[model samples]
Target: MAVTGISANRLELLQIANAVAQEKNIDREIVIEALEEAIQKGAKSRYGAHHDIRARIDPKTGELALTRHVTIVEDDWMPEDELEEFNDSAMVRLTDASKRDPEAVVGKEYVEDLPPFEFGRVQTQMARQVITGKVREAERANQYEEFKDRVGEIVNGTVKRVEYGNTIVDLGRGEGIMRRDQSIPREVFNIGDRIRTYIYDVRPEAKGPQIMLSRAHPGFMAKLFAQEVPEVYDGVIEIRAAARDAGSRAKMAVLSNDSSIDPVGACVGMRGSRVQAVVAELQGEKIDIIQWNPDEPTFIVNALAPAEVSKVVLDEEADRVEVVVPDEQLSLAIGRRGQNVRLASQLTGWQIDIITESQDSERRQREFSERTTLFQEALDVDEVIAQLLVTEGFATVEDLAFVDNYEVAEIEGFDEDTAEELQARARDFLERQAAILDAKRVELGVEDGVMAVPGVTGAIAVALGEGGVKTVEDLADLATDEIRGGYEMKNGERVKVPGVLESFNLAQEDAELLILQARVAAGWIDASELPQPPEPEYEEEGELAEGEYDPEAVFEDVAPEAAADDAEVAEGDLEPTRDA
Candidate 1:
């Protein structure tokens, strides 16, 4: 066959392979393989099977070269005999081929040069197919390599196509998918529009690398901050936490290594330029930049910024924070639909309950108030009396009912017979009060029915009762001064009783018991049982001299005289003493 014009060259093929490798960013070997396949297909179409043909091009010159296969056979019935005879001289006889292969069989193969095959349209068409397919494969590989390392980074691209609500972005080198779920809601895009997104994921697919982009992920905010904040990029500010309700709001907590630099201000930039840029990218989603705080209370306060926090109480064991805010700021602190507090909780990994200042104050007042208000609809006088008795340090009405007549007489304005008669009434009151208090306790589900009485001194107990130290538990809740004042009572025109403080010479344990009794009486304790007070010691006195009158006689003359008419005092006629 005669050689055709513009013959393909090996050197040109090498140069084309190098250029393709560089242009496509693929291995040279890939281009080389494509070249070889193209050449083989072209050669097959150019030359018929009559000649065993192979093609080669000169590496230095633009020249095509070809080779043909010739067979050496000893007999006419050889494999070469089956081919259409080109010419009898084309086949080499066994005798002449013996020098090359002494053991040559009936059928033998050898290579010889043939004239370069002519370039034809059929061969060119075949080569084009091979080259196109190979180049496409190389381009896909190059695209994959270009984007694999870029996953989780932000990128800008033009909208190439939209299908099924997804946007296919043209990233110059490859296509990236912005799925419907990842796209901002209510956003519309047309071809040729420029868009920015986070490279959320990259995966190798059967055809190419699948590049996925997102605008909805929480990390997108972090990435945006990294891009806009120099401190973040330089490692001076670190994003400690982030939370987002995509297309609506996002919160980011940042910490700074340099004390002089404020992490929040750094991220916010001058006049809020930096964060505004991120918000613009997110399609008007709001951004909150907060300073990260190790103290949970401080962190919560920062998280709920712009609205002031009056107080934050943390229940560490419960992982919850109770935040108090001014009544006027409560709605602002809680935000619209609780968005502010929700984001703050998410940012700080805590459950936050917001309470208004008025609510808090009312709750505290209810807790520490001295008077107990019985529900008017549920009123029972016996119940009231029972509680009053318990408040007076008697755990059970039995203690009150067992008081002797003399003891009752000491209570003020009762004669011996009247005291006895009142005792009988006291028994009935005790039974009724006990039943009512126990029922009320059960109704209220009070686990600790009542606090034990604090084992305080008699003087202290008397003072506590008169001073409104009503319950054993109440005594416990009182401050030291309150407890000390409770022990001193008025004596006629003067207040002069030894209180717990005056009994300091007692043993430490005894003194503590006295304070404990005050605490119990204050209703600070819940247990019914209490430690008993120590027995009083008795000291015998020596006999006085014959002329010395008893010391008791000195104050006897001052005692008030009994009513000459023996008039009975009314049960409810007790009046406030002048000394009191």
Candidate 2:
């Protein structure tokens, strides 16, 4: 094989390049290009940085050519100060060039063949680095291009080794990493163990290709079911959503287009054989096949199966569900370490709060009593009218006041006169409440920009003021979640203080818009400007900064006043309570 040697041995260089290209699975031309670069680099180092030198490899016969050239100049083309820095070989007068090449003209150049360079230790090392670097780069490029399209596919490989608790798998084409957390919990694998993993991500890195593999990923389970069940593979049964705890339990919500086919049963297969196969592969992770339902309440009930949900109440505005079950089934519904409810929440994409039947009844009664009392106090009505109002979906004075008179007249037992009277009273009560809230807002020193925010009703403004959100600047600094619900700091914990959501009944969208408006008002972002791309992720080092790098560290000494605008609120802080 030809190596990167002198002219006699240069004929074999093409053989060396071919061997490298085959071994690295790269183009043979790429190897030749690397060799040319390496030779040129060695020549430059042996000569000088300013010398114009080039090396080329013969494509057919593996011959080598090394050349140095100089332009024959009629006049100086550069400034005198810069001209002094130019090398003598860079340009020569036609008179002097004729001494070397008698046919050389003013516009033309003189060329000389360079002698074969002896490969010195340092020069050889540099050449090797250049060649190796180009080869590795080409290999990484091949790896990236080969696997980028394979993401989300189940791949088969053999476990190569374990390092830092992560398993490295040698796929036939490339290597992949299964992060410890991405692997099934407590599942062990030895070197040479055959493994099937979900290629969840393919990221290009400075070092090489990063093929992220996962056995615990929900996609893995879904792919397994697809592979094991022909119905799923053929698209008879569609997997809607999947949630997994990895080696413990998983829930897969599926739907079938054909009315005759039962999606869950199809996924379960004959006597659970198919699911058991997936389970064995997952190290005994129990699988739940659930039928997808269009109705969210029905879906919630289905997701909380086995324990049998008795009732499901959804707060669509909050995207939260309250599920009530039999008292004995509470633990079962919640599962060990709340795994069942957690996976259920993930499957349904709604925050799930599990409660017992008895607790549900108590909560209903408490809400009923609170609304009734609020109606009686705010409208100056009797308990009968209050009860009617509560039963008719009038939860607050704001609700009654903001409602149209026709809506009030729609009450079963109420006539137009009575509706008008009730509405007048409700309006008056709201005006009084607003005046009080305005005073409190002013007294508490709320900023106008925060108050002007759409979701910051007079009462919510009072709450924000009390929470130290005193300026538009403060509001702008808050996260979108903070604007919706205030958070609180207690015992060095976030504690998730409620914000405008409860007080103003703001939706998540409302919070986002309100925060955006605040950002514009406080000059955080322009009203017409689109949000900028987020900064890239960076690693943090403790020794890099002398002090104050820890985000949570500041929370240790944070006083009530130091809490950010969206950063402080105890539960129910934003809930309206009528007090002068």
Provide TM-scores for the models.
0.47, 0.79
- The lDDT, on a scale of 0 to 1, for candidate 1 is 0.66
Candidate 2 lDDT trough over 10 residues, lowest sum: 547-556
> TM-score: which candidate is best?
2
Off by over 4 Å in 1: 1-29, 41-123, 294-338, 341-580
For residues 431-492, what per-residue lDDT tens digits would candidate 2 score against the true structure? 89889999888899886667776556786788778778888878777776665565777998
lDDT of candidate model 2 versus the reference: 0.79
| Residue-pair clashes, model 1 | 20
lDDT of 1 by residue, 1-580 (tens): 1112225455666677778788877887777667666766666565653445665554445355556667765545345466645333446777777877878765677777665555576666667778778888888878878888888798999999999999999988889999999988998999999988899888888788899998888778898889889899889999999988778888899999999998888898899999999999888999888888776677788889878987777766457788889999998988888888888888899999999978877765443222222211122223233233223333333454587657655544445655565456657765665576655544443323122343443333444554554454555565554433334445655555444343433444555555565555555564455576469989688884332333222122222232111233455532212222
Q: What is the C-alpha lDDT of each candidate?
A: 0.66, 0.79
RMSD of 2: 13.2
lDDT of 2 at 531: 50
